[model samples]
Target chain A: MTYDWTLWIVFILIGLATTLPRGSFIILGERASLPEGLQKALRYAPAAALAAIVVPDVVLVGGVVEVLNPKLAAAFAAVLATQVSRNPWLPFIVGMGVLLGLRHFL
Target chain B: MSPSFREGAREGFRVFLPLSVGLIPWALVTGMTMGGVGFTPLQAMGMNVIVFAGTAQLGTLPLIAAGSPVWLIVVTAFVLNLRFIIFSAALARGFHGVPRAERWLAGHLLTDGVFATCLEKMLSHEDPRWRLGYYLAPSLWSWLLWQVFAFCGVMAAGSIPKSWSLEFMATIALIVLLVPMARLRPMLLAALTGGTLAVLLRGMPLRLGVIVAIIGGIAAGFAAERWQGAAR
Candidate 1:
């Protein structure tokens, strides 16, 4: 329960985090001109950040990097599944299936 | 609620519904993963509804779990959502001379999908009223789906099996989002270099490797873009 306050504070701060940037232009669109270099960096940051997050989750098991892991195999399988289907859920479905199947068998 | 605004809003909802439907899986997964983080279901709901950012909300969870400094959590979320700056700027520029209220509201509602949809539609023929209505209408529809689905997930979270590791679904979803971007050379470089560095630096305390990876990835991508430009 002690963490409740912290969580609440986070909610408010996050709300600002989202609203502020999104509204940055509306409030100052006429005067605000993001640098061309900044824009390019922003374009690539999300993919990179997502990659960072996803890499550790799948490649590392309990902190140490493990070669033989269900998550790792599932990730590769997910890439293949996505290539084959236009279905939005195909990657998740195939990846999870592989993960569970491998976990059960191995 | 002028006739023009109402008509535009109707069209907007029709246009954005298909994309909003795609958000369902992501919304539910976010809710479930949030619940699995040991927060109460109410807290989970609050995070989704109040923050109203899927990526930032999910990205900040590790910091919250680790009991990282409050400032760090806020800064991380802000960095994670930096794309909104580009999105909002482009969106706002197109709405030149729109009413102040509508402009502000549109900015608040400027989501990734909404920004893209708004840009694709030629709303300039219509007045600011219609444009504002069009933006608000679809956003309302999307927000409703986000809340309803996320709420359902949080409620059902208790009965969900823990051993299944449903939280991993968030990672898988992110992977799905990332894979298509790999087709772009600069993006591929960023992801590969960033992801590898993250693994190498995973030992960073308070999960600070994420921030480092993001910066490194952006630098690599910038360098790649400049290199490609020079080569051409």
Candidate 2:
């Protein structure tokens, strides 16, 4: 377990940054109207952010795109599962199940 | 203090309960990973309480382990959480009428799930007070569950074997949660674009690839929306 003064400083900085996003508008209250283009752009943030996190996890191996792997297989399977069943749990279950099965049996 | 508040709280909790199922695995993984990476229980708990952003926390852990400079770690966390800035701005409308202190507290507790749920509820409900309660209930619930599950993970760290591939399970959870959010064409475009580019640019240093992918996806979505508007 690593501990030092830097951890606390980094923690505080990240904490403040995290809070700023959630608190800024709420605190300002009356003076918060983003421009139309920016607003439209921001609407896409969630999907973009999620993709930014997920794609690399599945497709990239050690910073390089790997074509053959169980992780990629599971990611594709998850996408198909979502298409077949709108149930959110289905993709996760199917993907994890596929990954486990592939790892164990194949 | 009122019936509306009570009802709103209940509904908020109810709405959040389903979404939280997806996050539980990730929370556990976070705790396990924290412990695995040599973070003391105290550090893990502090991160769970203060940082509260899973993606950012996950991103920062590796850098911290690498003994990266404090500035770099801070930058990474900030960029990963940049989405929250947009979330907060969007949330302003929903929480416009709420008091200052509550609003600030709400911001501290805000998560992606709560923001989405609250936005949906705000669209459906006209009452401000109920909306506040609705938003607060789930935010608090999520915060509580995150802490509890993460603590459990830290405690059970060595007990859980690595071969379980728990890390992959967390990834699956994220994928499942994200795929549903792509119902609209613009959203679908954004996800595809971001996902594709993220893979293509995975080699980029400092995880800047994620930031690049996000910006590209947003731009692509914006273009698609504009084209659809023009066509319509």
Runs in model 2 lying further than 4 Å from the true structure: A1-9, A83-94, A100-106, B1-40, B54-87, B90-99, B116-135, B203-207
Q: What is the TM-score of each candidate's chain B when compared with the real chain B?
A: 0.89, 0.73
- For each candidate, the DockQ is 0.65, 0.53
Best by DockQ: 1
lDDT of 1 by residue, A1-106 (tens): 1356668878999889887888887667577788887898899877888888778878888889997899999988888887999787788778889998999999
TM-score of chain B of 2: 0.73
TM-score of chain A of 1: 0.86
lDDT of 2 by residue, B56-77 (tens): 7776665576576676667656
Model 1 over residues B1-232: C-alpha lDDT tens digits? 6898898889889899888888887788778777766668889888887888888877777657667777777877787788999887776656666677766666666777887887756336447666766788988787788888888777776677777766676677777778888899999999998899889987787667777887899899989999999999
Per candidate, the number of residue pairs that clash is: 0, 0
Name model 1 segments beyond 4 Å from true: A1-3, B66-72, B98-104
Error of 1 at B164 (Å): 1.0
After the best TM-score superposition of candidate 2, give how far the Cα of residue A68 lies from its true spot, in angstroms. Answer: 0.8
* Candidates in order: C-alpha RMSD to true structure: 2.3, 4.2
